[model samples]
Structure formats: C-alpha cells, structure tokens
Target: MKEIQQFFIRNFIAVPVSFGSWLYLLFGIGMNIFPATGLFIVLYLGSSFSIKQIQLSSNLKQLGMTRSEYKHIKNQLTSARFKVKQLNSFYGKVRSVQAFRQLHEINTISRKILGIVKTNPKKFYYVEKFFYAHLDSAVELTSKYSMLVNQPLKDKDLKITLQNTRETLVDVNKQLEQDLRNVLSSDLEKLQMEIDFVGVTMNRDKPVLEMKGDKYNDRK
Candidate 1:
C-alpha cells in the first residue's frame, strides 16, 4: 500500500493523463470527427489539476503538512544538507589540527541539526530560520579559511584572518547547538515539568510514621 501511494505521488501527472489519452484515442477512432485537439486540451488540463491534488493529498498524509509547508521544509533540508556536505569536504582538505578540529565540530553539529529536521519536519520552521540566518555564512567562511590555509605563502594577515574565522566558526557551532535546543525547547520544558511534578507527588505521598516511646505508630 505504501509503495502504491509513493508511485502515485511520483507519477500522478503522467500516468492518469496518459491512460485517459489512450482511452480517448481508442474511442475517437469510431467517431466521424476525430477529437485529437479536444483530447489534448482535456489531457493537459486534467494532468495539471491532478498533479496539484495528488501533491496536496500526499503532503497531508505523509507529513501532516499543506503543500506549501512540505515544499518549504523539503527545500530547507536540501539547502542544509548541501552546506553540511560542503563543510565535510573542506574538513578533509584541512591540514592544521586547530582548523580541522573546529570544522569537524561544526560538521557534526550541522549533521545533527539535519537529522532533527528530518525526524520532525513539522518542528523545522525554527531550524529553517536559523539555517537561513547563519548557516550559509558559516559555510562561506569555512570555505574561505580552508582556501587560505592551503596557500603556500605564510602571510601574517592571512593567518590572522584565518584564526579569526576559526573563532567565528566555533561561535557558529555553538549557535547551531542553541538553535537545536530552541527547537526542542517546548518538549524539553514539558519533560522537565513532568519530572518535577512526579518528584513533588512522590515526596508528598511518601509513607510517614510517628514514633511513640521507641515504638513506631503508622498513621493511615
């Protein structure tokens, strides 16, 4: 059933319209006037509308999302994934432990953020906003720093800029962690509140005894 639904989502535009066109062709052969032109128009319109309907229904069923919401989340994930790949590639080229260490940390956190987005796409709006705000700049800075480090010349200014960029990337990694925490803040808060409630109840309802002259008396 899942495979069938996936097939429909992928081929909804072509399959139905093609089937209808074939049927129309078969029937129109017996008629006095061939309806080739009309059939083409109907098939075109039918495919366009069917594509939209299928997309909306698929989004709702798969992600509990509207068409636009699903598209937005999907595009954001794609962009984030691309940035992660870029960072990972740069990490490979890095020779200095200091630079590679920060890039590795950034790559790990970036991948974690992507995993969170994939697992809970509905909760991805905050993550998407954060990615747009800071992720691209981090990628750009890392790429530039990697290029500078690879150059043979030991220019003092270039080294200074690279060190500064490395610090900024460290901050960016921290920002990614904070952003992920923000996305899960509601769930974390709920969990903490539940724990507190449990602790209070446990303490309040705990068994107590009254001692009378070394003899314990149970108070029911």
Candidate 2:
C-alpha cells in the first residue's frame, strides 16, 4: 500500500512540473515540437527517478538503515520473489497429491514471509535464512523431486532419492514456518510494547482526563 502511494505521489509531483517546462520550451521559446518532446521525456524520467531515490533514502533513514543495507536487503527480496514465482511452474509438473500439497505449502509460506518483509524491509535481518537458504532449498529440491517423479521407470536408487527429497522438502517447510514465526514474533513484541505504553498512558492520565472531560475532547 505504501509502495502504491509512493508511485502516485512520485507521478503527481514529477509530471505536471516537468510538463510545465515542456510547455515553456515549445510555446514560450517556440522550440521544435520533436526536440521539445524529447527533452520533456528526458526531464520527466530524470525527475521521477530522482524523486523515487529521495523517497527511498528518506525511508531508509527512518528505518535506521544505510543505503547499502537497504540495497542488500532489497536485492535478496527481489531474488526470493522471483524464485517464488518459479515455484508455480512446478504445479503442472507434479503428479501425486502429497507432492502437490507439499509444494503448495512451501509456496504459500514463502510468499507470506516475502510479503511481510517487502512491506517492512527492516525485517529482512531477522529472517535471513529464508531468503539465503531455505527458499533455495525448497525451489531446487522441488525441481529435483518433480524430475524424479516424472521418470518412467524408477530404480530402487531413484525411489530412495525421491523419498530423501520429500523429507528435505518437509524440513524446508518447517524452516519457512520458523522464519515466519521469527518475523511475527518481532511484530508481537512491537504490539506488546504499544499495549504497555497505552496502559501506562491511561493510568498516568486518567485523573487529568476525567477532570477535563467535555472540555476539549469533542472539538478535536
């Protein structure tokens, strides 16, 4: 939602301002329409990009992160998101109900984790294992399992490998759940802190609030 808001804000700030310059160049100075349009495109793109970067820097500062840290986390998140999309390709490749269910669980958990971090990039530090390790494991092992499951005639070795892959996917699923738990635990901690703060505020201000009741409460 914040990202969507930023998109609109960037365009709103950059578009008409850039277009005004274009209007001046084409009409005020009577420059050729073609060159003026070209310059307008360039100016619009540059200003839009600059505004986005400024917003990003400001947000990163508020998050107490350096630009380098933000880029690192964002890169990992982009990679992980791409890999999650790849998981969809396996749905048609998988056969058994168990295999499909396992893949679905992993994909669902991964997306939820990624959604949380993408919304609050600072949480990446708390759940690095999902982006760094377990997600890769889930994608790679699922691919391998799909291939093995598709074999026309499986030898005893192939069957054992399939079992091992399934077991590994189970572990991956659990780790994804753990990563989610870690992220949610952070949210839970923040919520508890807020609740504690509200309790304190009520206790400390109750008398004053009662004394001043109906004074300024409804106006604001």
Candidate 3:
C-alpha cells in the first residue's frame, strides 16, 4: 500500500501538480486572467523546492545514512584524485609518501566502514575504478600504511590496536575490490533492468497524464 501510494505521488500527483502550476504561471498570468501570478508562484516554489527527506524507516534497517555518506565519500575520493593528478602534472612525479598517506586515509575510512555498510555492490565497483585508476598511488599508500603499522613503539596495546585496524582495513579493501571486479558484469546488468522498469512505467502512463491535462484545461 505504501509503495503504491509513493508511486502515485511521484508520478500522478507530483508531476501534474508541477505542470498545472507552470501552466497557470505561463498562461493565467500572461493572459491577464488574474491580478497576479502570486498564488501560482507560491505553490510552484513550495512544490519545486525539495525538503531534505530522511527515510527513517530504511535508515533504521541499514544502520547508516546512505546518500549523505555516499556523497561525502565520493567527494573525498574525487578531491584526492584531483590533488594527485595536479602533483603529477606539475612535477612529472609519481607521489610523495605524505600524499599517499592522505589517499590511504580517505580510502580506508571510505571502504572499510561506510562502503560496506551501504551494501551496494555496483557502487563498490564504481569506487574500485577510482582506486584502480590510481594504482601506483594505492600501492604506495598501502606500503606507507604497512610501515606505520610495523613501527616499533612503547605503547604496546595502542600500537596493536592501530596495526589491527590498518590490517583489517587493507584486507577489506582487497576483498571488496576483488568482489567488485568479479561482479561488475552482473551488477551492471541489474542496473539496466532497473532503468528498463522505470522507462516502461513512464511510457505506459504518459498518455493518461496528457489526457488529464487536456481535461483540466477544458474545464478551465
């Protein structure tokens, strides 16, 4: 029932509401049928502007804010990639250890926890391209993390925890990368299936909407 309601709202209610408003604005105001387009303008603004919708139901089951986290992680990765590309372009060099560390930091936090939590294999594959595109940088980053983890230190427990975290992160990245590569074909196929579903539904209902619009205009 909820899904059907949502579908109706998205296609039937929302689109028609938007179209009616724009039509009133373009026609009713231009034709001097009303004192002003103020009412239509208000409704247009209200409906067109998006409110931040947190799907609390899905989040409760998923354990994380999926879209927000995905956007943040993607931004981080893109920024890192840009910086590395800039360095290589300027100096004709590969990468610095510190630069690699920054890359590693972004990847470790992005994949080890957030990416896995999202559980979207297609997204994982897309992100893997980001890593693979900078394979040299990634290898260097892994080496630097390895060195950091192996460094002898006085605080044994703290060192152990940090090493364990680093190793775990590394293992997770490798495993996920392989999984992404292996499933790329199937995941992409699934994406197409979803796209086809949306396309068919949209095509099926478009004429019904046109008919409704004609009726609404005739009534006016």
Which candidate number maximizes TM-score?
Answer: 2
Writing each residue's lDDT as its tens digit, candidate 1 over 82-164 gives: 88888878867788898788787777777877787776778787676567877887788898888888889988998898788
lDDT of 2 by residue, 5-95 (tens): 9999999988998899999999999999999999999999999999999999889888999999988988998999899988989999998
Candidate 3, run of 10 with poorest lDDT: 86-95
Find the 10 residues in a row with the least total lDDT in model 1.
Answer: 28-37
- The TM-score of candidate 3 is 0.28
Give the clash count for each candidate. 0, 0, 0
Error of 3 at 11 (Å): 16
Clashing pairs in 1: none
> Which TM-score value belongs to model 1?
0.67
| 149-172: candidate 3 lDDT, tens digit per residue | 555663877667656645654654
- Record all residue pairs in model 3 with backbone atoms less than 3 Å apart, i.e. clashing: none
**RMSD for each of the candidates:** 6.2, 7.4, 19.6
Predicted structure 3: lDDT? 0.51
Backbone clash pairs for candidate 2 read none
List the candidate 3 regions with Cα displacement exceeding 4 Å: 1-35, 46-153, 187-220
